[model samples]
Target: MRWTKYWWLVMAVMLISTFAVFAVHDEAKGPEKFGRYEFKEQDKKAATDECDAGGKPGPEFVPTVRDKEPNLALLKDAKPEASSQLEGWCPRRHCVEYLNDGFYNNCRSWIIGAIPGWAQIDIGDVANVNRIYFGSDHSQGFLDRTTADFDILVATSKADPNSDANTWTKVYTHKGDPISETTEFTFKDVEARWLRLHIRTNGGARVDEIEIYGGKDPMDVEPSGKATTTWGEIKTE
Candidate 1:
């Protein structure tokens, strides 16, 4: 009887341990409703207020133009081109006229511009986007401040090359400091063909690069159970 009881206790302990491990994994993996684009809390509040006040969300609030333009201009004076270098990935870069003054061994660079100036890229076909990465060359430059003042937009139609103006659905806006390089946003059930990085003001700094990733078919991977501490790491799961 003693031997049987010990054996049962050992088995129970093992089962409990396994259950705990799985629980932790599931918690860390996060939620399944991860968004492709998300707005800052403050921005969300403002948007909500505007919406409640009978104001439309997105470009409706973005100023039509700026009083002054940034000294920097587009490098090629051409729009971004789609690249499939990363396999099922399309990446592009839009440079401001200004470059970093060789910070981070030239790793840190930026393009300064005014509000309403933006970089728009096609994600190819209407797909659900879930992740984004944004970085600046120099976090202290004039354009860095613009990140917070800007709003990211997405569109469901192919861009018209002949038209100077393109229409996109505004997704979210930044509310944190301008110097942050690695920022992430989450959007739920958003489908679009193009993504636009729209700045409300230059914040007197330049943007080094903005990356959009994650539109793959949903996977059944187990959750990691680790929670994100920063607002930038917003995950849908």
Candidate 2:
């Protein structure tokens, strides 16, 4: 009877420890819901203010265009593709084709759902790429409809480039309360043939353009003119 009692005590202790571990794991995961979104408390506050106010949530973003260096993604041999097309309303507008087209207003590339979305550009051959300029359509009038967080990934491979299973080196990770109309991110030069924009979370985004540049640092270049098509033309087109 004493041996049986000891066995029960051991089982009870094991159960308690297991529950404690589970509690810790959940705590480490952090809060599951931040208002309507699925991360961070700050974002929740920003999102709340966005709705509370009748206007835009954050400051308007104006992009300083870089004219000195060429946009490598615009190369004739370069190709861009996405994980999937965002279906329903504006089906033609939200597509992978518009990603590098130099338009910031007319059409946008969208990726929505619990599963993350990815957009990648194959810059033909390996090049020293370090700067990326990303834009989202702010005309939509909702901060939640913009990229919240994403990652910049690079890879050099000849086979199955589109496959998620392929090895990719993450160069930068962007955490945006709301990604700007034109957000520029720079990293150490990576000699790569493929560049990927992995969208981890977006409420409902209209990713307008992603321009990849190689060679010179954009800061050294003088701003001669805007790099993208003017808003006046894009809205009409």
Best model number under TM-score:
2
Note the Cα lDDT for every prediction shown.
Answer: 0.37, 0.53
The 10-residue segment with the lowest total lDDT in model 2: 228-237
Candidate closest to the true structure, highest lDDT: 2
How many Å off is the CA of 154 in candidate 2? 0.5
TM accuracy, model 1: 0.42
Off by over 4 Å in 1: 1-110, 138-146, 158-166, 218-237
| Error of model 1, residue 139, in angstroms | 9.9
lDDT of 2 by residue, 62-153 (tens): 12224445566655456777776567534335557656543343233444434477778887766677778765653433334577677778
Candidate 1 lDDT, 1-237, residue by residue in tens: 999999999999998975653222111111212333221111323322322211111101111111221101111121343211112111112223112111110122234443345655554445454445554422221222335565556655556422234545555666555544335565543555566665555444345444454333322123322222123333211
